[model samples]
Target: MPASLGLLRALVLLLLLLAFLDPKWPREGRVVYLLDFSPSAREGVFALAERLPREGIFLAFAERVERLPAPTARRLDLGERTDIQRAFLEALKLSPDRVVLVSDGLFPPLAPPFPLDALYVPPKPHVALSLLPPPYPLYGETVGVGVVLEAPRPAEARLRVEGPGGVWTRTLRVEGRKVLPYAFPLEGEAEVWAVAEGPWGRSEARLRLAPADRARALVLGDPALARYLEAQGFQVEEGPFRLPLEADLVAVGLGVLDLPEGAPEALRAYLHRGGGLLFTATPRGLFFGGWDRVLPEDLPLKPLGREGAALVLVLDVSGSMEGEKLSLAVAAALELIGTATPEDRVGVVVFASGHRVLFPPRPMTLQAKKEAQSLLLSLRAGGGTVLGGALREAVDLLKGVPGGRKGILVLTDGQVADDREALLALAAGAGAEVSAIALGQDADAPLLEALARRGGGRFYRAATPKELPRLFLREGQEVFRGGALEGRFPVEKAPHPLTEPFAFPPLEVLLPARAEPWAEVLLRSGERALLALGERGEGRVAALATDLSRSWRDFAGAAPFLGGLARYLAGAGRALALYAYPEGEGVRVVVLGRLEAPRLLAGGKETPLLPAGPGRFEGVARGEGVLLDGKRRIPLSLPLPGEWTPRDGEATLRAMAEATGGRLLSPEEAGRGVRRPLPLRPYLLLAALLLFLLERFLEARVPRGTLREGAPG
Candidate 1:
């Protein structure tokens, strides 16, 4: 053969030889397709499978292989609902190079099944942002909107607001693939239409403003009286008189004035609207008649005659009153004293830097009257004004004063102090009216007006002390008259059903009404007990007693003491009522009605039985079965096991099965009190075998090759 040709032929032969002994290069790229086979996911899975590459591995979740498509490189059909975590474990065994998840975004939180390089295929109509407050309070109050977005990566969207008002838009920058929060501040009582426009589509929400403030009022007289009705901070306005209108309260003063032209109609309207009216009038027949006509027929006002009532004159002799005011005040005090009855008590308080009680509370005898007159004449104005202190001291002197309606007539001529609230409190404590006589140019009219209102007394302006005498002596009549007998009774401690060692307070008794009363005594440790009072002759005595001066420091005068006494008389008759009871197993089951059965659930089955007596039950339980109509079956093996402890040893026996997972039952559940078979170990062993086979198969197929290897062989 020729050498060159032979060489060429040899080269060809060498190439053929090399081809015969060829080392195949491995295919490095992998294709992994994950299919979801959940009940609602079938259509999506089929669509994904149709679009998937035929040569790639196929994994179907929540369904078996017989239920899925063919032509898969490596097919894995999962039976039952897909466990995302288990699916990931199975996926790692296959060790695919490329991975894809095909389903709706609603998937369980699964461990990473594949590397980060894997591709994820999400289905369409992917809820970009879903607003979730449906059937919400819209257009009436506040509304909340929840936005949910579906995306593999974070999305930035804007919420475009549109409604009857106009268009306003705000941008929402979402960082992760989830729902985001945004709040809308809607003000006033207006309806707002809202729609959230995001990357996907628009979600609608409606917001309606709640009712603003609808509070109405009805004033009996001129709306001017409504102006004075400012205690609860309500806005006052004038309106025609109508009966059935929504007003808080009505004030009728100076009695001569008729209800406005529509006043009768307004009064009817007022009553229908739940209105309360306060009527103030002098004892004059003309004024009283006018005042009586305006009041509701149910509350008739009666007038008491002058001359038999107890009255105390309280005069303020501060430095601002160094002239004519002093003389008038002294005369007023003497005249007021002269009107008092022999049985009526009279006290005088003259205040300058501090208060000086001219005469302590004493009956109106000639000597007492004479002494009071002497004290009034000796009054000297020389110190700084402390009207609040004087008012307080005057009230203190009237403590235990003998009068149904006790009061102090005050005469002041300057802006003494700023303790009006304290004076009001002292007046309330004494339950006494404080009539004020403002004298001179320095007298504060507003302060006097407020003082009169707070003390439930009348305000009069007197230019000098001479006018003060007339003002004080003119209102010498009492509206109500009654004597108070004050005394204290000792209390003892007793056991209470709901509380321990219930202690009572020292109680006062009022005469003429034999009433039983009760009081709530609060202890230092935040516990409370009720103390009852028994009926006494002509009055009622509370079992609990406390010193009026010490325990009830806020209540100082006869009226307040009598009021407390009346309350005690009303509450002592009723016995304590049992509200609830305790039940078995440290469980406090409420006693709904009279329980005729035992309160305990007993026997091997914890059967509920009828109680033989109060809070006690009688029943039997044989085994582990709960009582149906007072009888229950007990599992045979429950009480037999050495490790099992019988809840009721006398009625139950514990037994153990040879199978590792079998549970011992009490004889009652066996029906015939016989032991039964429980096979659990077989299932456990079968599961173990399955796991071992799976591990072996995984070990045999997964990569054992090192990265240094050029290719997989």
Candidate 2:
């Protein structure tokens, strides 16, 4: 049989098969209209309905999906939420051959079951800032709250963060999708409000600020620490030293055992009655003073074991540092050397017209101490002072040694030739700390003070050799007591009443001391205790090996740490909190602490917050007002609803139609019913038949050639 004849027979057989399948042409049939009744889509739905084909079936959906009898002027209230997917899925159940969706396209894109067409309504461009849920904060703390801001373009927005401390207003530039953190100062009462407004949009969130109660404390000897405690929400009264009978805490500064006439008695009574007493550590208090007498015998603190310390002493033997000044400097050096145990390594750097290392860091053994004293006694004052050079040499010597608690103590009676302040600042990052002592009146007090502070060590000033104490020396020249935790170190908090998720400030004073067996260590530096607590009879007692300067007067971060500590001492726990924020079209209220009865008052309506679980409760409310729980009233503002969340919905509509083999329709096309997808089987059958006939004609007309088994044609 010829190939063309065979192809013709095959085409005839395929044509019969195509006819049997019975493919239909494009035509509108059994059409269904899925209408969006959501608030964002309502305007587009009603307007489109007037122009939509009345012959088609109609279904309306928002919170509920249902068939509509007809397009009418009356609007049905099916709640505010828009559910486009639900409406489309229901339309398929009706066996519609074609589905047309009318909406603003504000809902998530949906892939319809049948060929779908869409009439889109676009929403206006909007900007909004939604605050994340806030946490129940402690008194005197800054709550860092996150807010998400969305805008089509950059917006200059004004934000107001209000607390019991007062309202703080901030102006910032905002753009598309940025998460910003705002710190709200929580004061005596926990009620905070954050409001952001701009030309684009305005959003405000209110927190149920129910901060813990303020702690009452009696502070003696240290008003700086007292003031810092106040910033952290402590009611502090500076004193006559007589512990108030109702006081929750008492702090004695400088490790002074010399209590006012009735103080010791009052303190003992206070501790016995379950009050808290904080005692500082000092050499005078431990050796010369009455630390043992003040604290309970059972709560006695032990001195730190012999731990190695890296000591570098810089001395100036200039013409100005002659008789008494030189002697005093040597005496101070000797005292510092005495404090070091056999395990400690000590180095001495002396400068005259030049600087030289008298001795490198070596173990302070019996012979080493003797050799150091002999070298110091033989030193003579001469030439100009090279104080800066001496310090450099000392730091270099310290670097050679390894370990924590490394220090450089400088004894200078004259200013350096270079910028004295810059010279001291240079020592800030050399791995070791730099402390300075001014042996005479001419010494730069400010320069040395700066050096000591930056080095995380001590600065002392002496007018004459007489100012040097006999037994003990402390920072700032006034001495006698050696603090147990007596330097700058990062404090570690243990789980206790005195701790929270608090950002603790840098503490400058801590004595190397251990807590008593009866004491529960609340704070630590390395393995040593920084703050410890014990109880006796009805009273409580605390031992602070640090200088106990929770003073915010200089350090900004001191407030929260000390405030939380003072609050715990005053017998305050985490207080009840009521949180309310805008979610969707309504407000969500959450209760933090266990409350017998919690209620929200908003939009002139009162609603009770139901308990969800242990220490957790929640409910929903509409509009704005205040949340009330017992005597507490926290302001509330519910912002954007979910249906009103920013979205143009145009892309969603186009995508949905394209996904289901449909098209986005204009008002004119929607009125005539949606266009159906053209059938492909008819085109396939016609192309196949025509190609077969063409193939036969080409074969009959064109020249044909045949090749033998091995011959080329």
Candidate 3:
């Protein structure tokens, strides 16, 4: 209450409030040297880091972060997976006056706290190679092989390709931080090698290809069907019903009734162990033969067969189809007959000046297909092109048939010089799907395309004999699907490992069957699965109801479908790859897929391929042979590691520095060091307490009434 007491309290309050300021004295400066230790950084980065002034503290980072007590020149072994933001946060924790990052700029872009600067270390001079995608592509037609080349400066690169077509090379100049990319389109087996050799250093990379593949198919009990399988690009081998066969696919034409002979059971055993089999019907109706006891009922089959269509083939044996054209046409027809179901009624008509029915429309049994083939082979070519008479005969063959599924296929090499309008009229009156194929350069293509368009069928043309058979089979699909194509049921693709790179070919004839509970249905048409894959014991089995007898006529995705199916059956499902890229002074090899302790082999030596992640293996290759896993051989070569490809991250580092109100510095600019602000709050609090005690002592010494209110400084 006294004046001295009030003044002392005011002074205490003032001292306490000042403690909250906690101010500090400003000094010179201090810096934290943030260094990149990734493999991508220049080889001299470590030595350069050590040469910086002692005024700055050192911090190093790559895929990981660490604070260094002293500068050192060596690898941190912290992989190329850069985390700049994380590294920046760690540098801020050191509480320096400023932080300077010394790096090749390979680290990802980052936004740092207020006190971060960059001492950009340009990337080491080197040329490296890598594939565009980490994985290799499937082989079929022309497939593009992608290449990536990274260089610090303009590099002279040479690319070489060796394959079924032999070897060729090309040279070019590549530059800058952006990768120089190139793609080469190839078909069949191919191996490629690339080299970038110049003043910067010599770097190399190569691509290796698998051997050419052709599936071996076995045909049991029917040589007639053996020829049919060969047309599908398979290597066919006829059999006397033997076991332990060297075949990827097998077709059984015998009735299941002979199961007691052990042949059917043996085939079933083969299927169980991973062999592919088609329990196809012969000329005679397919007889299950009471073999349900030995064969699994889950096998997708159509014992009753499909209701078939009526197809008429009107062939032109005109003078134009005299030599190779006529011979190929006959061969094409022979393959065509095998596509029809036994229930389908098929007829063959030949025309030149006049027309004659070679084979009348009847059930297409095994005997019928053979008989048609024989009849077609014996036919001779002569006279002018006369299509009207052939159309009349074909119409007559389909007269009794319903309009729903009747078909007329007209083949010709010469233009219709006689009765063209009459033939068109006859074809229209038949109320059937009429498809046509015009052969050779002289054939009338417009008329054929128009006929097919009007009749709701696909038109085909074969400028060469090579295209004849495929066109024939594609027409079979229209006839098999019924007159106007009532939209055949769409095939449903199910998720499965076999469905990798999934696609469906245009299916012509699919046997209706049910899948068992354990069976894996990969493809389906309506409720019945068209293709089913399963593993029973030591082998794999596939039930493909879609008739492969139907040839392809440039149907999109069909070739891949067939190729993939054959490869899958032939033990190609395991995805294992070995790839090599430069890593620092060595070559880093990567293997994808499961394996135990895999290794990289080069120049007859082996190096351990260590586990890097789940399903991924990595290691360093010793030399350039690039062979590993006893199978794959990658031609890996590079003068420097691939991690140095993008050159440097100068732009990214500069942006981060500018964002934080910092300047890009050099390794020599390490003088920015000064201790952080010193706290004064503790001293101020102590002073306030001492003042309070002094005020209390004075009040006690002066008696209570003597403490009077007065203005005092």
Winning model by lDDT: 2
How well does candidate 2 match the true structure in TM-score terms?
Answer: 0.40
Residues 1-713 of candidate 3: C-alpha lDDT, one tens digit per residue: 47667788899999889998776665666677777787657365775855776656777787788877766744577766557778878877776777777887764465677567777776766656654322333333223444666665566766554444455566767674334334432334566665556666676767665434456777655454465445445677876656666576766655443322446567766666456665443322122222221253435433233457888999999887888998888887876676666767889999998889898888888798788878888999999887887887788778876535788898988689765566566656777888889887888898888777776666887889878876775566546642111224467889865566665655555555556566777887777766666665544556555434442234555545654555455442233454556554465777675355666566677777778886578877644554355454444443333455553477777888888787777665644454556578888899999989998888788765455434354
lDDT of each: 0.44, 0.65, 0.64
Best-to-worst ranking by TM-score: 2, 3, 1
Off by over 4 Å in 1: 1-308, 478-713
Using TM-score as the yardstick, the better of models 1 and 2 is 2
Over 386-471, each residue of candidate 2 has an lDDT whose tens digit, in order, gives: 77778877877877786666777777777766576667576787577677777677887888888888877777777776655331
Candidate 1 lDDT (Cα, whole model)? 0.44
Which ten contiguous residues of candidate 2 have the minimum total lDDT?
471-480
Task: Indicate the worst ten consecutive residues by lDDT in candidate 1.
Answer: 637-646
Model 2 spans > 4 angstroms off:
1-16, 20-22, 25-27, 124-131, 144-183, 188-207, 211-561, 564-641, 675-713
In angstroms, how far off is 485's CA in candidate 3?
29
Candidate 1, residue 116: how far the Cα is off, in Å: 99
